[model samples]
Target: MLKRIISGLVGFILLLTIVIKGGMALSISVLLLSLLGLYEFNSAVSKNGIKYVSIISYTFPFLLFLMFNIRGLGLNIQIILFIYILSILSILVLKKDLLLNDISVTLFSLLYIPFLLFHITLLDGNKLIWLVFITAFGTDTFAYFTGILFGKRKLCPELSPKKTIEGSIGGILGSLLLSLLFLKIFNIEHYVQLGILSIICSIMAQIGDLAASKIKRISNIKDYGNIMPGHGGVLDRFDSILFTAPIVYYYITYLL
Candidate 1:
């Protein structure tokens, strides 16, 4: 418990620093996080002992390039897909021992993990970005403690035994509190819309966590890695962010 609190506070402070001072600081932090997340994701898929070294190696640069070149006739998007195809081809040449199924899994994993996550940070508005962060991590925090205290019905016994319906409710309510607090703190426009977005983010965050748990359960592994002490791995930490950021980004841009 103490470890979780300390880590959470330290992480929040680091994030606040990045957001408070935007530009290179913010971009670099996001870039580093994206790369680390890719690494963790590669690790998750590598549990099968498949030779995916090339695919994982190319993930960071491909995601970063895709992020910066998001415009211009959708060429960037096409190029990202091209790279994935090349990665699949490379596996045939470079890792001759790897079979078709292994290469296919690696391709799917890259497409979903780093490639999908890269877009979330590109969205406008620091407040919206911060909302993604809060929604992702805040929901997890609430769910953890709530489950510890009041969880009764198991949300998914096979994937995550501790998760419960009670805890999920707490997660959503906690996200609402954080969302309202940030809106009030930053004085952003559209209070009602932001609240509704927060609800969406909270639900998506839980789904993200559960999604990662399913991946872990399928892989038959414990924590993705011990990168964050009590927090498991980079994937474990950013699972919610991976799914929630994209949703929030889409919402802020398209809907509200």
Candidate 2:
């Protein structure tokens, strides 16, 4: 318990530092995080006896970041899709055994970890960037205590037996309250939008958490990695953020 708290504090401080120092600092931080997350994910998948092409597994994420970071590069969606299709075709040609599984898992990792997380950079210079962290961490904190105090029914026994339905409700309520507070703090009048966003983000965060838990269960591992001592790994810690960032990005971009 002490280790978890200490690690959480240190991680929060580092995250805040990167968020405040947006620009190259944020980009570099996301790049490193994406790399580490991909490493953890790839390692877990490999244990399932799924093999991936080393070059594609590592290089594609860097390419994704480069595409996002370098503006006007003409490396738009169509081009990116082409590259992925080409990569998969190459895998099919070169590796005949388990080609479909290899391609699917590799592509899933690319979309899941780096591609989704890249939206944080897209949210640069927005005050709502902090909301990403708030929604994720707030849900987690509230869920933990709520489950401990009033948890009777399991949320999803198969995926995560520790979670509870009451805890999930608490998490959403917590996120909504935090969102309202943030709106007031920023002097934004879009109360309804913020409320809706909070609900969506909280649900997405829980789903993200369950998804990671599912991965670990299938991999037959306890945690993604042991980098964070009490926390599992970068993926384990930021799984919720992975889903929330993209949702918030699109919401703020189009709706708000």
In TM-score terms, which candidate is top? 2
Residue 102 CA error for candidate 1 (Å)? 1.9
**Backbone collisions counted per model:** 0, 0
What TM-score does structure 1 among the candidates reach? 0.88
Residue 211: error of model 1 in Å? 1.2
The residue-by-residue lDDT of candidate 2 on 1-256, one tens digit each, is: 9999999999999999999899889988898889899899989989989886557767766776778778778676567867987977787897668568888888888889888898999898888888899999999999999999999999999999899999999999999999899989889878998789999999999999999999999999889998997998999999999999999999988997
User: How many residue-pair clashes does candidate 2 contain?
Assistant: 0
- Cα deviation at 203, candidate 2, in Å, is 0.7
Q: Cα RMSD (Å) between model 1 and the true structure?
A: 2.6
lDDT of 2: 0.89
Q: How does residue 58 of candidate 2 score in lDDT?
A: 76
